[model samples]
Target: MEQGQAPNGLSSCYRHPGVETGVRCTRCERPICPDCMVGASVGFQCPECVRNGSGTGHGPDAARPRNIAGGAIAGGDRQLVTKVLIGINLLVFLGGLFFSGLVDELVLIGLAFDPELFRVVGVADGEWYRLLTAVFLHQEVWHVGFNMIGLWVLGGPLEAALGRVRYLALYLLSGLAGSALTYAIVAPNQPSLGASGAVFGLMGATFVLFRRLRYDLRPVLGLIVLNVLITVVFREVIAWEAHLGGLVAGAVIAYGMVSGPRGKRPLLQWGACALVLAATVVMVVMRTTALV
Candidate 1:
């Protein structure tokens, strides 16, 4: 007799006697028809077991460890996107250290977004990717270190709350906004690079998120104030314009994310993000044209 044949010389599934099946449920060890089979880590499961949520594979919570400080505050399972961003920044910095040519061609002149590049080379030559590429360039160890620390401190919780997609959108948009503002107001030949703008964006997003939750806003606000003071005091060295632009963009995007229409929050949130990005692009075009 065949492996699935019954004593009566008939081959059939346990759930559907008329249908033949050789597959068995992993948990219940019962024959399962194709229609009733649910994919599992070890093996397929029957519809009954699947309905009961029985599976060897872990669910989302298990896959992503919850933050001990609660999902709102920092310190928890590291968000992958945040980690990747930091890693990229470090790699670029490291490359610049080892390869002088890399620093000259990619970091400073080519990748780093600057007013002159955007206005002259970028607009005329159509090399606009510098707007986003510049975010990864860091000239000094401290420059990358401080910005990375900020990213690590703020990114995990923000990623957890906003989710990976929205979190990334917020970061990139903030960076673009920051650079755009810098190009618009800074010296025509001034050069700006690094993730400081994006980091500032994270801080801004956290502030708005906490406010929405009705959490005490003093800590985040104080931190922002301190950073602002530092920017103001070091006006010549620091790109305060970029920081302010990032902060405003982040706060506005966070507001849209938290205050969107019910049941369509994701859609509205993404739409708001798109609008922010579009506005930044428009700013870039206008600034480039004016400079030209």
Candidate 2:
């Protein structure tokens, strides 16, 4: 017999009796197969031990692991929200391909005439949903590809660190902040669309998260600098306003997520997000007032 294997089938996994395994759960000492292993801070734990939060030598009353934002550490796919967002963006892109009007209807516009609709239509005309819909809108293949890659790269870590709800809030609010700024500053008749705003927001949040964790800042800083340069150099084609808005909003929100008293973390974090949203609303209202 192999080393560490028990005799007479005693080494079989408790959860999978038919499968023989020499590995025992670190928490309960029960034989566990590779499929049943759940990584912990220490050795691998069984599913039951992880589920009950009893693997850390603490009693059953011990709290489950939590992320930086006080969210329960999720098992399995940590980037689920990021994946869903990408899927939605892709679906919208596909829909736009078949229905040409979909892009015009969803793209961000402060005020513009829709020839198809035979009337004036835009955010200023009370199409408030455009503020959000525009976030998922994309016309060019390159645009969507670039934004999706950034989302996959930067979004995964932030979602894992901040948890799903908080990360979703950050992403959406950042995108809205970008749209609001574009609406407020750009010509009312001008149009814009893309997920760059949200992607830039994630970049900003990644910077803050890395700083909080005391990781090497050079990589993130370099990326931010490079992107900012690209925005500046291509300011004529690029919506620098959206990028700027997202970056600032993301950093501010992430700071709120990582800083402040631990006792009041939830209140502080959500309060910061609320403040950003309120500010975006104000920008939209003020711009609409001016346009109309």
Which candidate tops lDDT? 2
For residue 117, give model 1's deviation from the true position in Å.
Answer: 13
Instruction: Give the per-residue lDDT of model 1 (tens digit) for 1-292.
Output: 8666777754578767778765656444567778888764224667766665433235653333221111222344438899999999999898878876454344212222444333334321355666677778888988899999999988977887666667888999998888777766776555667788888999898898776544578999998999999899998988887898799889888877876333476676777788778878887777767766
RMSD of each: 15.8, 11.0
> In angstroms, how far off is 69's CA in candidate 1?
19
Estimate candidate 1's alpha-carbon lDDT, on a 0 to 1 scale: 0.70
Supply the TM-score for candidate 1: 0.68
TM-score to true structure, per model? 0.68, 0.80
Superposition-based RMSD of candidate 2 using all C-alpha atoms, in angstroms? 11.0
Q: 177 in model 2: Cα distance from truth in Å?
A: 0.3
lDDT of 2 by residue, 1-292 (tens): 5433567744777877678765656445667888998865324568987787544445544557656665667788888999999999999999999996898889898888889867888999999999899999998899899999999999988888788899999999999999999889999988899988889999999998777654578999999999999999989988988998898899889999877655688888998899889989999999999988
Q: In model 1, which range of ten residues has the least summed lDDT?
A: 64-73
